[model samples]
Target: MKILILGIDGYLGWPLALKMGSKGHEVIGIDNLSTRKFSEEVGSDSAFPLPSPSDRVKEAKKILGINIDFYVKDANDMEFLKETIRKHKPDVIVHFAEQRSAPYSMKDYNHAQYTLDNNLGTTLKLIYAVNEIDPSIHILKMGTMGEYGTPSLDIPESPFVEANINNKKDKIIFPRWGGSIYHWSKIFDTDLLLYFNQIFGLTVTDIMQGPVYGTRTTEITEEGLRTRFDFDETWGTVVNRFCVEAVLGLPLTPYGKGGQTRGFISLEDSMEALRTLIENPPKTGEYRLVHQFAEIYSVNKIAEVVKNAAESLGMSTEIKHVDNPRIEAEEHYYNPEIKILPSLGFKPKKNLKDEVKIILEDLIPYKSRLERYKDSIMPKTKWKK
Candidate 1:
């Protein structure tokens, strides 16, 4: 199968490309390198230095004997994107190219606008490009669990809910409202994909993923093939941030009462989920939604896990309650269904403790770099005025 991965320079994208190439698939990777540039602009560069895309492809060929064609281009440019699509004519398109940080989107007006434009514009262009070339191309877009926010009811894999109005029965996509501008952009992407599927018979799969943690994968061993690892408040997820704090001997910062519960997945599990979806393409004119997560943990629970992991390794860590900066519920109901991938023979291998141990050991060599950016680990962006 020919696979094209956008945002192939991302934390998840880089590893996915390697996995696909190793599986004897023809892989073409594309990225604009915006995430790296954004991290530099915000003083939160990756803890581990990353090789350029060209260097990475060159190294993979020499070491793994896998050839991956890589191109540096912006996906928002309709003309360039269409040309690439037509040239490659991929069987599956994995769309991971977006500004993927809630706090970064809420930093200011400019950041918010950039997130909205870049994320939505790219999806819109992809829809058009696929429609023009071949509607049979399966599009696997990366959606977020944040798009559902804190709804009153349990979240389903597909947001569609059964409804009866005036003795007439119908099923509709659940009402979606996001917590931040970044999440809102994902909601827009979901709706747009549904529209394209309905109108143009496009086959699309939107993986509503949870917060992903860890920095290691089976295919990524050498330093040159490593994915970027960011542990700052802006780009880091809660679990990743907590592990870094434990390693640095700093208090695990929990916002408010720390009752915020969310789903999480190890980096290895995330890659498997993508692979499963790519192999099993949905039927034509199908807009499939699969909630991709391994386990669920609250903010306080994760902090305690990190603390315990550190203590077992002969290191003491602290947990501190910090003032909440985001405009979200301190405590709420969050039950999300994620049985689709498991039913498809995808099993999550690593638990929270296992993931923490892997991440802590991986960062041992970068202790100095972690300490240098420790001051920027606290939340600085607020969602409210």
Candidate 2:
């Protein structure tokens, strides 16, 4: 199968490309290096310097000796994106392209506008390009569990069925009202997927994933080692940040009452979920929203876990209650039911002490670069009025 991965340089994208290539798939990767610049502009870069996508290909070819094609193009440009899709004729497209950080999105007006425009613009271009090129090229987009706020009850698997007026029972993909700009962009992304499915009968699999944790995948050895992982406020997941803080002897910055909960996935499990979904595309004209994750943990729980992990590793840590910078619930009922992907043969790997250990190993050398900025760290991206 010909698999095309957009944003091939990101924390997840790079490893995912390697995973697919290792599976003997003909892979073509593309990225504009926007994430590298964005990481620098935001004051938080990767733990180790990551090679450019080209250098990554060189490294992979040198080690794996499997030829992988790469293109440096922006998905926002419809003509370029369309031409690539038409030429590559990718059987599947794993779309991990977008501005990922909530804090980065809320940095300022210019940043906010850039996030909105870049995310939505690229999504629109991809949808149109896929329609024009090949609707069968399944687009598996990543969405956030943050899009589903800490509801005061159990959240059903991606869609909830409702018996409405006149006893009409219809299923609906779970409605998403995101808490931050990063998540809102993902909501708009699902809308694009649904529209394309409606109009052009495109196949889409939007995985509503949670804060993905862990750094290295099985495919990444210490050598052939241009693959990068970030543990910064900009691109870092919550668990990643807490682990870094624990290692640095910083207080676990538990915002608000620390009851806000989100689903979490190990880095290994994330790769498997994507691979499983891509192999099984949604039926034409159908957009499947699977709540993709293993377990849910609250902010306090994460802080506690971090503290424990730190103590076990013989590091001192504390949980300091910071004023919740972002607007969100402190204590809320959050029981999100996510079983679809697991049923599709996705056995989630355990992400407890051992998982934290793996991430700490990757981040130890770059500990000096971890910022202590509490002000610009939390989710604060407001919706456009």
Candidate 3:
């Protein structure tokens, strides 16, 4: 298969590119190297120096002997996107391109606009480009479980159609009450994809992914000791954030009530589910929505795990219930159904101590970076009107 992937420099994008290339697929990656720029602008590069996106391609070529072509381009540029699509004529396009950080999105009005411009603009360009080039090109883009706020009701598989009356039944898309600017942008992407599918015969697979965990992969050593991504407030997810806090002797800053539950996935499991979905795609004129959650964890549960990891490193820890920075319930109901991926044969790895140990072992040398970002710990923005 010929695959064209956008945002190939992100945390998941880099690994996914390597994973697909190792499977004998011809992979072409495109990125503006924005993630690294964001990290640098915020003075928080990965724990270790990551090679430039170009360097990554060069290194992967040397190690795996799979020469993946990479281009530095913005997906929002419709002309470039269309030309690239026409050139590659790819069988699949995996889009990780978007401004993905919720906290970063809420930091200010400028940040919110960046989210809008980057997320919506990119999708619009891709949809139009694909329609102009080939509507049958499979678009496997990342959506977030966060798009649906923690509802008291169970979150079903994506896009639950409703019927009000037999006499008058018009189709309605599923509920998406986003809790942050970032979440709302993803909801917009889903709507856009659905629109294109109905209007232009496009095929889109929207994977509603949870906050993924784990630091190791089949290709990378358990103790690879590279600049594992941060555990800081700006970039880190809950589990990774806690791991860093615990490692650095900072308080595990649990916002609000510690019972806010969220779905989680391992990196290995995410790649496997994506590959499976690619092989078994939806109909060309259809929009298939799949939930990518593996397990659910609350603030308290994640904190406990981080504390345990810290204790294992021979350091006692602390949990600080800071003022709920955002206006979310300190504790809220959460139950999201993720049925498609497992049925496609995705086996999840649980929160094993050894996995946490490997993460700690890799992060041991970056304790100073953790300390440097500690002052930037507070949440600075919101999603509510």
Q: How accurate locally is residue 119 in candidate 2, as Cα lDDT from 0 to 100? A: 91
Winner on lDDT (2 vs 3): 3
If scored against the real structure, what TM-score would every candidate get? Answer: 0.98, 0.92, 0.94
| Candidate 1 local lDDT, 49-69, one digit each (tens) | 999888999988988889998
Give the worst 10-residue stretch by lDDT in candidate 3.
219-228
Model 3, residue 32: C-alpha shift (Å): 0.7
Q: What is the C-alpha RMSD of each candidate to the true structure, in Å?
A: 1.1, 2.6, 2.1
User: What lDDT score goes with residue 136 in model 3?
Assistant: 88
Q: For residue 252, what is the lDDT in candidate 3?
A: 90
Q: Higher lDDT: candidate 1 or 3?
A: 1
Q: Write the per-residue lDDT of candidate 3 for residues 1-385, one digit (tens) a residue.
A: 9988898877788778778888998999888878777866665767655776677777787777767788898887888888888898999899989988887888889988999889999988898888888888999999998888877888889686665867897767777888778889999999999888889989999999998766766655422213247555677777777777777777898887788888887777777778888888888788899998777888888788778877977977899887665657667888887778778777776553456666777677878766777665555444453
* Candidate 1 ranges beyond 4 A from true positions: none
| Candidate with best lDDT | 1
- Between candidates 1 and 2, the lDDT winner: 1
Q: Which order, best to worst by lDDT? A: 1, 3, 2
> Which pairs of residues collide in candidate 2?
none
lDDT of 2 by residue, 67-159 (tens): 788888887777878878888889988888898888778767888799899999988888888887777778888877787777666677655
